[model samples]
Target: MFRPLELFIGLRYTRAKRRNHFISFISLVSMAGIALGVTALIVVISVMNGFDNELRSRILGMVSHATIEGVRDSVKDWESALAKAEKNPHVLGAAPYIEREAMLQGQRVAGGLVRGILPGEEPKVAEIHNKMKSGKLTDLFPGGFGIVLGRELAYKLGVDVGEQVVVYAPEIRATPVGAVPRLKRFTVVGVFEIGMEEYDSGLAIVHMDDARRLYQTDGPDGIRLKLDDMFRAFTVARELAAELGGLYRVRDWMQGHANFFRAIAMEKRVMFMILSLIVAVAAFNLVSTLVMLVTDKQADIAILRTLGASPGTIMGVFMVQGVVVGVIGIAIGTLLGVVLALNLEAIVKFIETKTGLVFLSPDVYYISDLPSDMQWSDVGLIALLGFVFSLLATLYPAWRAARTEPAAALRYE
Candidate 1:
C-alpha cells in the first residue's frame, strides 16, 4: 500500500501549506501536546527511580544485608557462627550483635532499641563508624559502659556527648524492700545521624559486652552479615540458615523493610499510570488533526482515486502523514527528556544558587537534593506507547479518507 507514489503524496501533505489555518494550528497543537506528555513521563519516572535508589542505600547503610538469629534467644556460639558465615564467598563481612528494648533517661525520657556490638568488628557489617558525629566507636570499651546515640534520639533525651543517661532494662531485680527495674548508668560517648527518622530516633549503640550485661544475655543475639551483592540477600540468608543446621532463622534486608519498599514501588506504579494519561490524551488529539486534514483534502483525495490509486494506497497516504507527525513529537520529547534527567541535579543546584532558595532542606527532609536516575528501558517503553497511541489515532481518519466518493468530492471541488 505504501508505494513510492503513496509515500510521496503522504509526506508532501505533511509538509505542504494548508489552506485552512485552523487545521494547521490544530496539527501543531497535537504534536506539541505529545511532546510535552512524553517529556513529563520521562522526567518524573527518572526522579522516582533516583529516590528509590537513594533511600535504599541510606537504609541499608545501617541495616545489614542479612542476619542470622537464634530461634529461642541469644546465639551463644555467635563467634562460631560468624566464622562459618565468613567462609561463604558471597558473605563479605560478619559481626555479632545483641539487640533489646530499653528506656533512656536524661533531662527527658525516651524508649529505644539498644544494639550491642563489638567495636572492632562492627564496621564489617554496619556503617556506624562513618556516621558518627562525635567521639569514636573505640570509646565503648568492654567495661566503660559507653554508649552511642542516634542524633534524633539524643535530642529527644536532651543529652549529648560526655553526658550520662540512665538505662532501665526490661528485667526486674529483687530488692530487699521490693521489686525494682534493673538499671545502669551509661556515659554518652558518641552520636550518629543516619538521616532516616526511624533509626535516628530510636536506636542506641553500645559495646557487645555491656549489652550482654544489661540485657542478661549469655552472648550476642545474632550474627549480622554483609554480602558482596545485596540483591542476593535472601538466597544467602537461606544458605546461611541451612549451614547453621536450622538452629537459627535468617532475615534479609528486604524482609526487614518490606512495607517501606513496597509502598515506594506502589507509588511508582501509580505515578506511571497517572502520567500515561497525559500521553494518551495527546495521542488521541491526533484523531482530530487527521480528521480535519482529510476534510480539507477532499479534492486531493478525488484526484488520487480518479487516477486509479487503490483505496488502501489512499489510506496509507493519510496514515503516513499522521505517523510522521507523531514520530517527530516522540523524537523531540525523548531527546529533551533524557538530557534533562541526566543533568537534573546540576540544574537544580544552579537554580538554588541563583535564587537563594532551598528546594529540600536537610533539617526537614532526609534527602536534601533532587536526584534523577534515567533508565533506557523506561524511555523506550514511553516512546513505544506514544507511537502506538498515535498509530491507533490515525486509523479512523485514514479509513474515512479512503472511503470518500470521488465523483461527489469532485462535484464539490
Candidate 2:
C-alpha cells in the first residue's frame, strides 16, 4: 500500500524514541487527557438523556395530554364534550374526571389532590390502572365509596389497604349555625406507586360517583384527553376548544409542566458547555506537545526542507501527528463511554448492593435508580468537537515548523 510522504514521516515521528523523555511523556499525557474528557462528556450527557426520557414516561403517563373543562365550575355536558374531542383525529381517547384539593387524615395529616375516576375509563386517559401497587382499580366501586391512595401518601398517613381515612373537602357547607367544611370517611381499597415523589405523595383516586357526591356536583368536572402525540397537545387542545365553543376551556400537560421541562433543557445545555471545557483544556495540551516536538525536530525539518520538501508538506506532517493522537484518544473514550452508559443502571445497582449506599433515593429524587440512555448523536457530536479542537491546536506549532529557515536551523549543526 502507498502512503503520502508527509503522512509516513509524521507517523514515524510519533513512534520514534527521543533523547528527551519529557516530550514523549507529555504526548502520552495529552492523549490521556483527551480520552478522559471525551469519556466524561459521553457518560454525563447519556445520564441526562435518560432522566429526560424517564420524566416523559412516568409523569406524562400519569397525567392527561389535555383536558376540556367548563369555564364556570363543572362541565354539565361532559358527554357531548368527550364526543366532540374524540371526533378530532388527533385525539386518542377521552374520559370524564373530577379533581379537588383535600386534606387526608389517618394516623397523621397530609394535604394533596384527590381525583374521581371511572375504573374502566381511567386507563384511557391515565395509566393509574397499570401503576397499582396492591389492590385493583376495579375495587373503587361508585357506591362502595372506596378510595386508592398513592404509596407514599398512604405511608405518610400510616394507613394501608382495608383501612379507613378521613378526607376534608375544601368546599364549605351551609349549616344552621354557620358555614362548615365538608368531610368524608373512605375505605382504602387500593394503593398505587408512580415512582415520582410529587405524585406519590400528593395524589389520591376514588370512583367518579363518589367524587360527584362528595363535591356536590351534578356531572364530571372535566373531560381528560389522550392525544396521539403528546407534543401536539397544545395545538389539539386549541382546536378542540374552538370546536366545542361557548364557555369551554382547554388545558394541557405542557401548560402545567412547561417550566419543569424547560429547566431540564437549560441544565442539559449548560452541562454540555461546561464539560466541553475539559476537552478544550486537553486540546490545549496538544498545542504544548506539538510545540515541544517542533523544537526537538528542527534539525530533521531543516534536512527535509533542503531535500525539496515544501512548507505545506512540513505543516501537513505535524498536523497529521497531532490529529492522530486526538483520533486515538477519541476512539477509546467513545468506546468506554458507550459501554458504561449502556450498563449504568446495573453498575449502579451492583455498587449500591455491595457498598449499601443509595445514590438516588426515591424519597429525594423521585426515582430509586439511576437511568442511562446513550444517544449515538451525542457521542458523534462530542467526538467531532474534540477532533476540531485538536486540529485547531496543531495549527500554530505546525505553521512555525513549516516556516523554519533551513539556513538558520543548519547553522547550529
Candidate with maximal TM-score: 1
For candidate 1, the per-residue lDDT at 233 reads 92
Q: Name the lDDT of candidate 2.
A: 0.91
- Looking at model 2, report the run of 10 residues with the lowest lDDT sum: 361-370
| Collision count for each candidate, in order | 0, 0
Query: Distance (Å) between predicted and true CA of 283, model 2?
Result: 1.6
Q: Can you give the TM-score per candidate against the true fold?
A: 0.94, 0.93
Model 1 stretches with alpha carbons more than 4 Å out = 1-4
Residue pairs in clash, model 2: none
Which runs of model 2 end up more than 4 angstroms from their true locations?
A: 1-4, 176-178, 361-365
Q: In angstroms, how far off is 192's CA in candidate 1?
A: 0.9
